[model samples]
Structure formats: C-alpha cells, structure tokens
Target: MVAMTAAVGARPARAAPSAARLRAWGRGAVGAVILVAIILQAGAAPFVRGLAAVSVPSVVAALLLTAAATAAAAWRWRILAGRLGLALTWPQAVSAYYRSQFLNTVLPGGVVGDVHRAVSHGRSVSQVAQASRAVVAERTAGQVVQIGLAVMVLVALGMSAYAPAVGIVLLAVVVACAGVVVAAAVSTRARDVVHRELDAVRTAFGTVGTVAKVVVASLVVVAGHVATFVVACLAVGVDAPPQRLAAVALIAVLAASIPFNIGGWGPREGAAAWAFTSAGLGAATGLAASTAFGVLAMIAVAPGAAVAAASAFHRRRATRAAAVEESS
Candidate 1:
C-alpha cells in the first residue's frame, strides 16, 4: 500500500513535466514552421544578403538605441516592482534587464529569461510571488501598448493603399489574449493567483502619474526598436519612406513579441517578410532587414553575457568566503 501510494503521488509530478515539455516542443515547432515557410517563400539568399549588409556605424547606432530602450524598459520594470513593494534600484534593474535580454535572445521560447528574472529577483527580495506579479504586469502592459502603437502607425501612414493584414492579425490576437485573461480571472482554481495579479495591476494603475510614466517609458522603448529597425533597413539598402518603414517595423516588432519564437528568430523574420511584401517593399528586403536587426540585437545584449559571468564569479567567491568563515 505504501509503495502504491508513493507511485501514485509521483505520477502527477511526472505528468506535469511531460506536459510542460510537450508545450515547449509545440512552441518550438510553430516557430520552426514559420521560419521554414518564410524560407520557402522568399529563398535563402536574402538572409545572406542581410548579414553582409551590417556596417560598423550601423552596429554602433543599434547598440546606442538598444541601450536607451533597455534603460527605459528597466525603469518601467522598476516602477512596477516598486508599486508591488519590491525595491529595485535603476542600476540593478538595468543589469537584470540586460541579463534577461541575453537569455531571451539565446534561449528557446524567448521567455525563459523573464522567468529567471522574476524568480531571481523574487528570491533576492524574499517575495517571489510579488516579483513574478511585477514582471507579468510589466510585460503584459508593454505588449498591449506595443500592439496598439503598431495598429495606429499602420492606419496613420495611409496603409489603405497597401494591405494591412498584419494589423488585422494583431488585433485578433489582442482579442484572443483578452479572452484568455477573462477565463483566467474566472477560473476557480486560479482565483487567488488571479486576484493577486490584479492587485499588482491595480497598484500599477492606481495613479495617473504612474500610468503616464509607464506610457512614456513604453513609448521610448517602442520608438527605440522602430528606429533600430529603420537602421537595419538602411543597412540592407532599403530606402523606403521613413513613415512607411516605421509602420512595417512596428509590425515586425509586434511579431517579435510572439513567445513561440526559437530564441528570437522565426515569427519576426516571417512577419517582416509578409508586411514588407504587403507594402511593396519586396519580401527579400524585409527578410534582410529583419536578419540585420536580429544580429544587432544579439550584439546589443553582449553585455548581458559579461554580467552573467561576473555574477557567477561573485557568487562563487561569496560561497568560498562563507565556507571559510564557518571553518574558522
């Protein structure tokens, strides 16, 4: 009876990991399919062309823009964390953001870095749940604002002359996301968790100043991304109208926000190809631009690698010190 009970208890634990792996595999497969489809549609030469187009000056410019955006994102994260009673200094937040970006860029699913950030920060502050809530609220707000900005740009740029299919798809996605939120809110099992998340959200939006600050920070982050995309476009020799390029870039950015990506590939390149083709910029141009952007992004997060290494070194040193103290 004891052995049977132990086996039964372990069954749920094993099942949970199996289901998690399946979901992760499904996400990776979706990203792979999208990437493969883009390759089939546009051929592989554009990717090669895109990588060869990056210049020293363009990389420098992208690095600066990425830094600015990362700073603003970190500020926004700090605000959310602060509202939730988690003290996060700007420097600390920026370091963490860089680490998070590096992980997101190199890891599958594009969000493992964020999970690490939340859990790490939570442990640091001894409030894992609130830290998680802060990260979730900050990321959710950023995505919603980003999607809204993308739609506005497409419409404002007179996209009636071209297809706005990407914008429509984003809108549908937003609706679907809203439905998921509602379902979670109404879930009996997740009631307490949902309520706690709501409390974080409520605190974040409790003041007009807080709301305005978040919007400004989010806008800066969005603008930096859009500008970096334009730089990528120029590097790839696509001299389209700045206004139209901004719209297309925003759409690509929206697609990059998709969590199904392999590291940071797949959906972004596919969407850029689609949107650029829709706008008569040629699928090749779009793919090349996105490829350059991806390279620049990885370069931009190089500091994160340094941060991770330094952090590990410090941790080891501290552990050694503690062990020595105990021995003495």
Candidate 2:
C-alpha cells in the first residue's frame, strides 16, 4: 500500500527547456517587436534616403573591419580559455568562440553562449563557473581600457564640454565593475554561490601568467571592436570627431549587454541616434550608421549558424553511433 500510494502521488519530472530553445523564443519576440516599431515609425521617405546614402566602399570597409574585430575577439577568448587551463588548441578555441557568437545572437540570454562554450571545451559545471570568472575579468579589463581611450580622445579633441557627465558615468561604471570583481576574488562564499551552475569562473585565478595574457588580449579585441564601430560611423558620413565616435561605440556596446533586446536592436539604435543627435548630427545619419553596423553584424554572424548546425549534427551522430555500439 505504501509503495502504491507513493507511486500514485509522485509525478515524474518534466524535462526542462533547453537554453537554445529559450534563446530562439527570445530572439523571435525581439524581432517581432522591432518590426512592429519600424512599422509604427513609418517615416518611409527619410528612412529610404538614409539607407540609400550607405556608400558601397563604406559598407565594404565596415564589413572588413567587423571581420577583423571578430577574429581579434576569437583570439582574445582563446587566450583566456587557455589561462583557465582548458586544453583547447588555437583552432578549437576560435571555432568555439565563433560558434558561441552565433548562439549569443539567436539565444535570449548572452550567457547561453558562454554556457555552450564552457561545455564544448570540456569544463565541469564548477570549472565552467571558474571560466566565467575569467571571462568577466577579461571583460572588466576591456571596459576600463575603453573608457580610458574615450576620455583621452575627448580631452585631445577639446570636447571637454561633454566630459564631466560622460566621464563621471564611465568612471562610476568602471569602479562598480572593479568592485564586483574584487569582491568575487576575495569571497569564497560568492564563488560557491555561482558554483556548478556557473563553474567556469571557479578556476578563475589558478594561473596568474595566463590571466595576464587574457587581460591584454581582451583589451586588444575590445579596442578593435570599438574602432570598427567608429569606422561604421564614418561610413555613414557622420563628421563627428573621434571622441564622439568612441562615446557612441561605448554606448552601443553597453546597450548590447541588456538581456531583453536581441543584440540590443532597439536600445542600440536608440542610443546611437541620441548620441549623434546630441552632437548636432541628424537622426537619419545616426540611424543609417547604426543600421549599417547591424546589417554587418547579421552577415558576419551568419557563418556561426552553419557552425552550430554542424556541431549539433556531429554530436547527434556520435550519440547514435555510441548507442548502436552498445546494443551490438
């Protein structure tokens, strides 16, 4: 009677939805909202004119720069993964990085990409959490470098008028981020909080030499990404000085960190529009530049979809083969 009652009362656990599936739903929702907003904005003539002004050479340059930025990013991540004591070869790291990029684009949560990369590189959940720590370290260092560059450019170009506000905000953000990293480093309890579920960050401080290499490489990658955004601005004929472009890049990149907006579509474009418009540029030009960057990103990430497909297929085939062998 006890066994029967227990069996009747206990419900079987339902399988949870995959991170990839959740990401797909999120991307679809974001795309739908953006489409609806575009329809409502419906100022057709200006949008058409702005898009038409996207020059061919400028587009080409934007594409090339984006590719370079992507490559640099892959290199940066590979270096970081090595520091975390992952045994990824150079090619493996680059491939995994690009694959993660595709996941990040289509998946709702940005960390979904990191999760996939962590598993692919053979990290245990705890190890993956440690690895995530390394990734955060790399990102924090890059943000600091970016803010410093923006401030320096603003000072050099006599754009000190906008400095106090933007500079203070940037500094505050950097300090907050630094505080978080420092706290994590000192807090074993915090490390345990994100344990198996975020384990890539656990082994985060194992090798100081490797960690330093990752920090430097990450800086170069982030700088390259910012430069590409600046080039995109030039492509759209924005005459703003370099400082302004840097500021715009910082705003756009920061916006992309938000989880809700499919690669930060609405927020990114809105930020660009506001930034450029404040500098006395037309919204149309800002939109064009932002749109160009978006399109380039879509194209650049297309290959990632193929990589993901292949990876899935290979994994499935391996599973089937193992099952067949076991049966035999």
Best by lDDT: 1
Q: Compared with the true structure, what per-residue lDDT tens digits does model 2 show for residues 116-184? A: 665455443335434544444444455555556556765776666556545555666777658656756
C-alpha displacement of 197 in model 2, angstroms?
Answer: 13
How do the predictions measure up, each by TM-score? Answer: 0.87, 0.71
When superposed on Cα atoms, how far off is each prediction in RMSD? 6.2, 8.5
Worst 10 residues of 1 by lDDT: 1-10
Model 2 TM-score (2 dp): 0.71
Error of 2 at 168 (Å): 9.1
Task: Compare the candidates by TM-score and give the number of the best one.
Answer: 1
Error of 2 at 203 (Å): 7.0
Model 2 Cα displacement at 169 (Å)?
6.5
Candidate 1, pairs of clashing residues: none
132-202 per-residue lDDT for model 1 (tens digits) = 67777777778778877776767788786434556565666678658657867789745665565567679
**Reference-based lDDT, residue 95, model 1:** 96
Q: For model 1, what is the alpha-carbon lDDT of residue 51?
A: 95
Q: Backbone collision count in every prediction?
A: 0, 21
Off by over 4 Å in 2: 1-60, 109-111, 123-127, 155-212, 240-243
